[model samples]
Target: MNTPSQLLPPPPRPLLLLILDGFGERKERENNAVHLAHTPNLDSLFARYPSTLLGASGPDVGLPTGQIGNSEVGHLTIGAGRVMHTDICRIDQAITNGSFANSPVLQNLLHQAHNVHRELHIFGLVSDGKVHSALEHLFFLIERAASQAVAVVVHAFLDGRDVPPKSALKYIQALENKLEGKGRIGSISGRYYAMDRDHRWQRIHQAYQAIVHGQGMRFPTAIQGIKASYDTGKTDEFVEPFVVGTYQGVQAEGIGFHFNFRPDRARQLTEALAIQPFNRFPRTPLEHPPFPHYACMTTYDASFGLPIVFPKENPTDIFPEVIARHGLQQLRCAETEKYAHVTYFFNGGREKHFEREERILIPSPTGISTYDQQPAMSAPLIADAVIHAIESDRYDFILANFANPDMVGHTGILQAAIAAVESVDQAIGSIVNAAQAKNGAVIITSDHGNCELMLDAETGQPHTAHTLNPVPFLYIPIPTSHPLPPFRTGGKLCDIAPTLLTILGIEQPPIMTGLSLFVSS
Candidate 1:
C-alpha cells in the first residue's frame, strides 16, 4: 500500500475542523431542523466542496447494531480512527455473561454495606436511553444488592433529553416494579441538577441537598413528585428536586455506587459525594458519615480516588498524540457544554493535553432553564475563537465544536432547533471566510444526529432522542495551489482521523484500522 505522503502532497497549513454537533441528513424534510432552516453557507459549501454522507450512528461509531450514536462515542471513534467499544457496551456484555455481578469493586461495596448493616445507596440517571445511564444497569445493580440481602436506596435522576420528554414516569414505574417492594426510592431530581458538567455549583448543590440531606420538596411517592411536575407544566428535565416518603439522607457510613458509565456528567457529582475537602460549593455536612465506601460503574477520573468496576482503557496513537509526535501545534476549542468532546473524547478519553496542544472553552449561555430559549448558543463565540486561531497561524490544525444543533435539539422545540441550525451556518460562513483569507482549508462534519429527525414517525410527538441518521462530511480546500484528491464516499466517523492525517502528509498509525477517505489514483 502507498504511504500517506506518497499518495498526498505536502500538508496544508492551518487546517480547520468544524464539528457541527447534531447535524445530520435525511430524505424527509418535514420537521427536519437543518432542512427547515435557511443555511445558505452550508448549502453553498456542499454544492462547491467535496461532500459525502458519513455513518455516525450504530456500529459505524462503535455502538450496538441498533443503538444510536452519542457525543462521547462519536468523538472517541473519530480520534481513535477505529471502532472503540464503549463502557456501556462492555458493561452490558459483562452483565450478560454474569461477570458484572462478580466484579471485585461491586462485590466489595456490597460486602461492606451488608456486613456493616448500612444502607447501600444506588444513585444515577434512571433511563433506558442508553446514552448516559441505562435502566437495565440500575436494575442489575439493585438485583445484585438484593441477592446479598443489602438494603438498597435509589436516588433517581430523571432524564428527559436522552429519552422522550415527560417519560420519567415510565422509568420510575419500571424501577418500582423491578424493586418488587424490596428497595425504596429515596429522592428524585432532573439530570440538569444532578449531571451538570459546567461547574454550576448552584445546581449541583440542589442535587447534593436532595441526596445527602433529604432537603427538597416532600412527596409521598416518586410518582406523585413527577405528576406534580407535569401538572405544573414542567417536563422531566426540569423536575424540581424532591424527597420521597420518610426518606433519610445518605448516611456517612453508607456505601454509595453511581451506575452512570459516562464520566463527563457524572464526575462533578461523584467528586462532591466522594472527594474530601470539597470546596466547589458549601456542602452540607452529613450527620452520620459520608460514604464509607463509594464506587462507580466505570472510572470517572483517577484523581477522584474511587474504585471503578470497569476502568477505561485510554486509546493510544490517537489524533492529538500523532500531531504532537509530528511536532505540529493544534487547538481544540468549544463551548463549555461540549468542551470535553473536543478535547477529552477527541483525544481518545485522555484528559491530559499533548505537548503542543492548546484548548479554549467558551462559556455556554447561563441562567437559561433550557437551551431552546437561547438557540444560538456560543456558536458565534466558538467560531470567533477558531477564526482568530486560524488567522494567527499559531496552530497547524484547529478544531472547534458548534454546539447549537445538538444542545437545542434536545429541547424538542422545532422553532428553536431551526434557529440553532441557522446560527451555526452563519458562524461557519464567518470562519470559512477567515480561513480562505489565510489560504487555510476547512473540514466540516458532525458527531451524531439529533436535529434532523424532529418528529417521531409513529407518535408524531417531538422526537427528542437522537436518530440513526448519517452525518455530512464536507472537505473544502480553499485557494490552494496543489490539486486536492476527491473524497471517497461511504465513510464512517472512525475514518476521520486517518483522513486528516493523510491530508497532513502524516503516516497512519498501525493501531488505526480505519482507511483514509481520500480517493487514491
Candidate 2:
C-alpha cells in the first residue's frame, strides 16, 4: 500500500467558499424545482448543465437507505469529506456499543444524573418518521440515562404529522418495554417515567362522539388508517388544520374542547395533519383531475381525529368534467420555468374537498398575498443574511437554514411552496454572487430532500409527504491565490468545517469527527 504522503492530492486554488441553503436539490420538468416562478439565474444554470440525484443511495435513507441523504450527514460529509450517519446516530452507536462513556457531553450528563437526585427530561419526537429526530436513538439515550441512576421524565413530542394518528401508543409501548425492570445491561438502578398529554386524547374522542352523535352518524366509530369507505367502522383519515392554533389548543385547552362548523352543528374536526410523503392521498372519487392543493400539514396530541380538513381549502367554481379536459394539459403546458405552490386552509365546512376530478384545495387565496409581508425581505432576505455575514467578517463558515421548500412543502400546498422555492432560488443567486466576488467556491447541498417526489410508483397517486429524495451536491469553483488544500468530493456534513480548515491551511483537532474535503490523510 502507498504511504499517507503519497496518497493525498495537492491543495486547491486559493478561493472563498459559499454554501447555498437547500441549493443541492435538483430541477425537474414535472413536479420539481421548476414549479417555482421567476428564477432567471437558476434557470440559466439548469439550462447550461444537468443535475444529478445527490446522496441517492446510502445509510441516509432511514437506515441509511444507501439511497437518500439527509441534511446533518450531508453537510458533515461535504465539510469533512469522510463520515457516516450523523451526530445523532454517531452518539447513539457510541452508547449502544459502549464507547460513549468517554464522550464529554454524554459523560457529563450521565455523571450529573448520579449527583442530582432529580429526574432527567427527554423531550423530542416520538416516531420513526426519522425526518427530524429518530425514536430508536432516543430510546438508547433514555437507556443510558437510566443506567446512571437518574430518574427520567420523558416529554415525547408526538409525531402525528409523520406517523399515523394515535400511534403514540406504539412508541410508548416500546419505551415502556425498554425501561422495564432495573439492573439490566443498561447500567442504572432507577425507574424511568413516561407521560404524554395525559387524559387529553380520551376527552377529544369523547367530544367527537358527542358532536357527531347528534348528526346521526352513530358514535362516529373510532378507527385509524384506511378501511374501505363501505366499512362502517370509523377510520382516522386525518389532517391538521392550524399550526400554532392546533398546538395551542392541546396545551391551553383540555380535551373535549369543541369547535362549531355550522350554527347548531358543533362537529369534531380531526385537526390531524398527516406527515407528508403521503400528502396527495388515495385517488378520491372526486370531480376534477387532481392538482396539488396543499403540501404541508401538522398534527398534535390534542388534534388527533379532529376532522379539521384534508385539502384545507375552498372548492372551485368549475366542474370536474371541465377540469379533467384541461388537467393534463395544465400540468404540462407550463411556459415559465419558475413555479410556486401556495395552500391555505380556512375555518369552514372542510379543509378541502375532492373536486369534480381529483384535485384538492389547500386554503383560500387571502393567505398567499397578505399585504403584511415585506417586499424587501421577500426573497432577498436569504442573500442579505449571507452578505451581512461576509461584511461583518464574522466566522468563515455560516450554516443558515431557509425553510420555504421544506416547511411549505409539508403543507401539500404545491403552488405556495413553489413560490417559496422561487424566493430561495433568488437567494441562491445572491449568495453565489457574493462568493464569486471573493474567489470562493460554493458547495451547495441539502440535508435530506423534499419537493422532488411523486406518488410511490405502485400507488400512482402521491407518495407520503417525506424528504426521501436524494439531494444534490453542487460545487461552484472560484479562482484564488491563497494556498488551498486538495478538494475532497462526496463527503458528509461532519466534514465541512474540518475541510474548510484544511483548505485554508488551518489545523483540525483529532477530536472532530470530520475530515478536510480538500486534503485527506
- Measured by TM-score, the strongest candidate is 1
Instruction: Report the Cα lDDT for residue 13, model 1.
Output: 80
TM-score of each: 0.96, 0.45
**Predicted candidate 2, C-alpha RMSD:** 19.2
Q: Candidate 2 regions off by >4 Å?
A: 1-28, 34-38, 45-126, 132-379, 391-398, 438-441, 454-468, 479-491, 494-499, 507-521
* Cα RMSD (angstroms) for every candidate in the order listed: 1.8, 19.2
Top of the candidates by lDDT: 1
User: On a 0 to 100 scale, what is the lDDT of residue 51 in model 1?
Assistant: 82
Error of 2 at 217 (Å): 18
On residues 1-521, what C-alpha lDDT tens digit does candidate 1 reach at each position?
A: 65544655556688888898998888789999999999999999989878888998878887778888999898999889998988888998999999999999999998998888887899999988888888889999888998999879999999888888878988999899987756899999998899888888788889888888889899999999999999998888888889999997876666799999898889898888878867887765633226757998888987877898999989899888998999999999999999999998998878898899999999999988789999999988998888888879898999899988999999899999999999999999999999889878889999999999887777666888888999999988757556566777889999999999988878889999988888776
Q: Count backbone clashes in candidate 1.
A: 2
Mind giving the per-residue lDDT tens digits that candidate 2 earns over 28-133?
Answer: 6455543445678666655543233444335532244533443333433443333433434444466567775554545555465566454443434455665445
